[model samples]
Target: GLKSSHFITPTPIQALAIPPSLARRDVLGSASTGSGKTLAFLVPMLERLYLLKWGPLDGLGAVVISPTRELAVQTFNQLRDVGKYHNFSAGLVIGGKPLKEERDRLSRMNILIATPGRLLQHLDSTVGFESAGVKVLILDEADRLLDLGFLPALRAIVSHFSPGGPNAQNDRQTLLFSATQSQDLAALAKLSLHEPLYINCNKPGEEGVVPAGLEQYYAVVGLEKKLDVLWGFVKSHLKMKGVVFVTSGKQVRFIFETFRRLHPGLPVLHLHGKQKQATRLTIFQRFSSSKSALLICTDVAARGLDFPSVDWVVQLDCPEDVDTYIHRVGRTARYQSQGKALLFLCPSEEEGMLQRWKDKGLEVKKIKIKQSKVGSLHQQMQNFAFKEPEIKYLGQRAFISYMRSVHLQKDKTIFKLSELPAEEFAASMGLPGAPQIKLFETSKANKSRGGVKQPEVEVDVASEEDEDHENVAAQSKVSGPSLKSVRTKYDRMFERKNQSILTPHYNSLIRHSSSASESEEEVFTLTRRDHDLPEFGGSTSGKSRKPLISSEDLSKRKLKAGGSKKGLLKIRSGPDKVIFDESGHPTTFYEAGKEAEDIARDSKLREKYLDEEKERMRKAHEIDREVARDKKRERKRKRKEKEKEVSKGFFFLSYLPPPPQPPPSPLFIQKWAFQFKVFP
Candidate 1:
């Protein structure tokens, strides 16, 4: 039932390696990016796995380990597709996900795709894989796995399948794949292979072959000018669907922000190591499935992750080494398809690296770019001279939101719009909606006609700026105040105006906020009105009525006297909200000093407890030292006593030696001995 098209169109790596691989040969594949290396081995491996179908009792028959979660997930997806018609179930086990879920899924999977760390964790635990009837072990990105210091773990895992040993195997198959093979990989190959049929896809003197269907180009510029060059490339090469490789997450965010600020419609995604697993998966899925493709990422994304239709791979940062250079460009021209690889290099550093690459037999063709060759957006920015920033179609706020999102952040605005009700928008903006419009300050001449409070009047949209200026000026022109006081007042007024305009936007963007303060009165009342009323009636039902204070009254009291009892009443009446100081301390305007004292007291108590604990530890150490000294002395005394006893026994034996001098030998010998003894 296999399609003829699939077989005939096998990629170069596949064509050269698949047959030998199927015949159970050891293959050394040196294919570049976009080579059909995945399928080349996957097909043969799957065929072997299918042949070894050990029934439902056998959980999995094959294992694949990849460097990254994204790559692992991607490989798992591809494997799932290939195994679909074959009725084989595949499971994923990667970091940042529950191991138990993976363990449960393993029960149903016929194959396991996992990251190194998580896989090792599962193996060390009660989760046994012997029942899975695992017949093959594949280390995809074999070089990367070794580079990540997974050798000990990998050896431990391999030790489990030593035939006729504790974790014995029933005839095994081993496949190792990498974009580039190093010495460590060779050592690992020995451990995995038992006289494998060796095949090398990249022959000597073919370093820059680039899969025959790939085009490569390089641009030389200053380090400072690389971002500008990238922007130009992106604008001109809109047709290309691919990734931009950067050196750091910061750079990923920087490129993302730059492009987003230039063009809002560009659907660009940023992928990096620091992002949450779910977020990275969503980004990967979106880019993989959609046509509007431009992914900006680090070299962590350079290999084992496949995107079949990718038309370009732009290296925004110069490669770390020759192998990295190969891996970065290999992202394009994958799977036997035609693609392009572009490298943006700094002028100062290009010569040495270029020569090194050439010595390695790589021809990095240089491409020229002039200012005249700049794209539309860059051209416009270059030509237009202005003091203020140009007001473009995309609003400042929207552009900033996009920029933040590109930092691989979930844009608060996007989340806000998705999660909130429309009515909350007006309140978020600090303005009442149309139906609830209580006061209007539109006509300055007719301010007295509507019976609205003069000081509490809201400015109309057309005159809001004028009102802000007037208020700022008035606040600044304090006659009976010190210069510092006037400056403070002026700053406070300006800050208030700016916040009043921007708070709604901020509130709208926040997915979670102070519900007690931000929610509407109706929401607040509904949530608490009945709940606060007790089933058992309180005694204060008919107490003296509290005076209803106006907003103006509270403000006037605060200005006249910094703190008053009535101000406390006003604060208590308002919704609960935290007031933080410059140092991020929780404090109230009235109780700041007392709160500071309480904080100091708590800190002192904590230090005192720690000191006590340290003292106790010091005493315990002294006691241990005394005990050890006593034990040492006791051992020394016992040794001395034993030595004394041994010495006494030897001394007594020496004194009794000669045993009466051979029983006086003979009568004449005794007489001669007496004469000799007397002379001695």
Candidate 2:
């Protein structure tokens, strides 16, 4: 079957790693992605299982740990195809599925492929999972798994297989596969492997690098012009299959909707962690089979997905790090195929990073843009007819959420809604509420303007008792003949009083309206007049007046005034609180029956409260259970639907009647007799 399927020779990695792995020796393999690494590990694992006569009763012989659920599913499918002739049974355990169902499926499988977090959940919750015979443990994309902050979970899981642990049964063979070898991988090997054999199929000089067939180029663009450049590139390659790598899920949806509207006839797909498992699976299958499609996604599609015939990989923005760049570019040019990668860089910030990459031996060249092509592409995109109604309304929520999340990042190069095009886009999406857009100006511009001054509004602080007096003073000032006349009148009034002659400080204040209209006017107002105070304690006879209270008493009063309302005690009202009753004795009861009724009522109320709380808790539990059950049912339905489709496609071939055999001619019979030396 391998020969018939055109598998004539093994790749370098496969040729080197398969033999040691088949011998049940722990192996740490470091090679770039698409170096035939999957087959290098999978073929040997199957052979070892076959040699052991692995069956359902022998328990699981191998377990593959992947970083992402998509990768795990891909690996599981490949393992099933390779092990079709054997008796090994494989099961997938990942998040977004019912734990109970996964637990049930765990009993009968000989190999399990799972993500670190989900597998740990099962090991901690499911009974008899640790006892399942797992002989060979493989960690795929080990660097990515650790980078995702799964080290603690991975440690907890590996502890179960320790020699002195409760679940330890046999010395397990370990295999670690990664594209790059970092300090983390070195530590991981010491913890997981026992003097493992090291296989570096990437060659001595070109180890830890991208494939040679992949062409790399970058374009330095203005921060605001990235979308324009990306649109041009995507439109230029509209008929070829490609994956556009973005930084976040928000960007994924944004780019997807943008291109989906610009090219409605094109097959555009999106993949991210937020999507449901089944939906992602269906999208993966569709894109794999699509001849010309566009997949806008984040780093989730960076590793382990084998997309066939991908012509190009476009980075919408500069990647966060070198490892990210390599993995993203690795998505294309798989299996020694020719592919191209384009990186969009902002000249002000990313030029340094680009130079660093070049210094590191990456053969990346700058792409010169044609002004006429970009202009024509932009015009074409604007003129394109958008027919999707959902795209018009979908990005508003995502945009708002992304803005809120990055509000504190202090990165000025990030896109802002203050730009005219962005504001229009937001308005078209039907975004609710007034969008708050703040534009950051460059330092050179600020220097040129000699530092722009912001308008200041001063607030006056006054006591509550003086609030009415301040308002009356403000009204009188406004009602005066004129500002100069009012000042003169206030001066005359203060001079006539001659009792310490209090004068108010005047200042001009401007208030701007919050209306969206462009023609709104700013309102200016003068400061309020000050109020006169009375002499202290009305001049006592032949003695100086003293304060009404001491400093200590004043502080105590303030403290009492500022006390919490909840801390105050309230008098209880009930028969139990009645110290004296209507009788001659000190303690006598006039109506004992009323008192008994009150006690009974209180008891009944307490019981009712408890019952209500219990009912609420029960309802909440029921709701959670119902949600889990619904998810399980939805997954089962999708699986059965997929199975039915597959079966129907081949069902006709399976059930078709044999073709009728035609009778042999006389001349053919004579020739047959002559050849066989016999007559029919």
lDDT (0 to 1) per candidate:
0.63, 0.69
Tens-place lDDT per residue, model 2, 162-183, is: 4421234676788899887778
lDDT of 2: 0.69
RMSD to the hidden true structure, all candidates: 35.2, 20.8
Q: Return the TM-score for each candidate structure.
A: 0.53, 0.60
Instruction: Supply every candidate's count of residue pairs whose N, Cα or C atoms clash at under 3 angstroms.
Output: 7, 0
What is the Cα-based lDDT of residue 362 in candidate 2? 70
Predicted model with the maximum TM-score: 2
Model 1 alpha-carbon drift over 4 Å, by segment: 1-9, 129-133, 163-169, 374-680
Q: Whole-model lDDT for model 1 versus the true structure?
A: 0.63
lDDT of 1 by residue, 1-680 (tens): 13632444766678887787676555666666666677877788789877776555666677888888988987877776666677677778887877677776666777778887887787777355553356767788888887657777787777765432124456666777777767887788887776665555675776534556778788876543555666777777776687898766755654565566567355889998888899999998888887757899986788767765888888876665677777777776665578788887655446667776776677778889988655434333322212223322112332233222222212222122222232332222112231121122222322323333323223122234566645644543442122232233334344553655655575454345466455655555744121222111223245533334333444554445435556444444444455887789886665876765675679787687789999999999999999999999999999898777666655554454353644755675546544434222
Q: Looking at model 1, which ten-residue stretch has the lowest summed lDDT? A: 528-537
